[model samples]
Target chain A: MAVAEIKIELKKGVADPEGQNTKKALELLGFEGLRSVRSMKCFQVDIGLEGDEALKACQDMCRRLLANPVIQSYSVELK
Target chain B: MAVAEIKIELKKGVADPEGQNTKKALELLGFEGLRSVRSMKCFQVDIGLEGDEALKACQDMCRRLLANPVIQSYSVELK
Candidate 1:
């Protein structure tokens, strides 16, 4: 079996209101000294294959479907 | 300061198409023996204050803006 973990976030140049709100909320909650915050999405997939085949499929999915190369980047970890 | 960790997922009764696709993609990637896969969003925030003030703000943010209480749940930690 193959497991791929994908994380997606806004491009660095983009402004994220969600992330900003989260940071503000954290401060209000009593978490001081916080310097930065960001928002991200994560996906864990279990492929039914093994080795190279699974890795290839994950990359293809990332390119073709899971993410838009123009706005998002993903890293795949296979186990 | 207060740091709220919020995890949002589609309600159990809701079907998650994105998650399903990710599972399929993973199988194609070669990760075998995987039993379950899910998609989630994560946020990390550093609040700029300290103590009780921070905690309260975080909760308020979660309730007022960060998440829809009807669809999401969150946990908070303070340091």
Candidate 2:
């Protein structure tokens, strides 16, 4: 089996409330010198396929359902 | 400034409904691949600090807020 790791993040200029809240929380906890924070999603998929086939499958998955192309971008790493 | 990317994942044995649903969705979409999927969260934090300070701060953030110690595990990468 092979593992495909996918990382998805919001596009630039998009507002991320969770990240904003986390920054606020950090500030409340006395952590300083933070310029910004952004949040994203990750996925680890175990597939029976191998090599390039695995990556191709994952890329299709990302485009079809894992990420919203309008506001998010994603990358897949197969191992 | 430095960027600290934190990837948070559910600890082994914890149920991941989202990943399960995603697998099902992929199958429904006629993508043939066998095995399992797991989901995680990632945070890209921009900090003004440098070197060890940034990594240490991010680790502290993970311990205190970014991850639930009982059910999730996280890793921080500084760039």
Which runs in model 2 stand beyond 4 Å of their true positions? none
Docking level for model 2: high
- Which 10-residue window in model 2 chain B sums to the lowest lDDT? B30-39
User: TM-score per candidate, in order?
Assistant: 0.59, 0.93
TM-score of chain B of 2: 0.93
Worst 10 residues of 1 chain A by lDDT: A25-34
DockQ of structure 2: 0.84
Clashes of each: 30, 0
Cα lDDT for residue A66, candidate 1: 74
Per-residue lDDT over A45-77 for candidate 2, one digit per residue giving the tens place of the 0 to 100 score: 997899998888889889998899999999998
* Cα lDDT of model 1 by residue, B1-79, tens digit: 4444444555565667878776676567654455666787766556675667766666665677566667666545564
DockQ, 0 to 1 scale, candidate 1: 0.42
Q: Return the lDDT, model 1, position B44.
A: 55
Candidate 2 chain A least-lDDT 10 residues: A47-56
